[model samples]
Target: MLTPESAAKFQEFTQAAMGRQTQVLINNSVVTEPWIRTPITANRIRNYCN
Candidate 1:
């Protein structure tokens, strides 16, 4: 379900969180290690796209 807008939003949110090194949150819980990776990674997104 990673549409362009959501993908862009993810990047925007993460980029905004740069420094202080905070992880991404979903339902008030940290998901992955900041910008290193997420539950849905780019490679997986490409697979879904194809």
Candidate 2:
């Protein structure tokens, strides 16, 4: 869960990264590079499994 401040910061980042390819990194390792289609401003993010 993101705190209110973190959520705002994430929103700002997404807006800045819009229309660009972004990399997800963990422990200095690249995870995935996804194109940013829209800005995400939600405070909570969820991953669903099938």
Of candidate 2, the 10-residue stretch with the lowest lDDT total is: 41-50
**Per-residue lDDT of model 2, residues 1-50, tens digit only:** 99999999988998999999887677988767777789988998553323
- What lDDT tens digits, residue by residue, belong to model 1 across residues 1-50? 67777877766655555554555457987665434333333321332211
Candidate 1: regions farther than 4 A off: 21-50
**RMSD for each model, in Å, please?**
7.3, 2.5
Question: Which candidate should be chosen as best, given TM-score against the real structure?
Answer: 2
User: What TM-score goes with each of the models?
Assistant: 0.40, 0.77
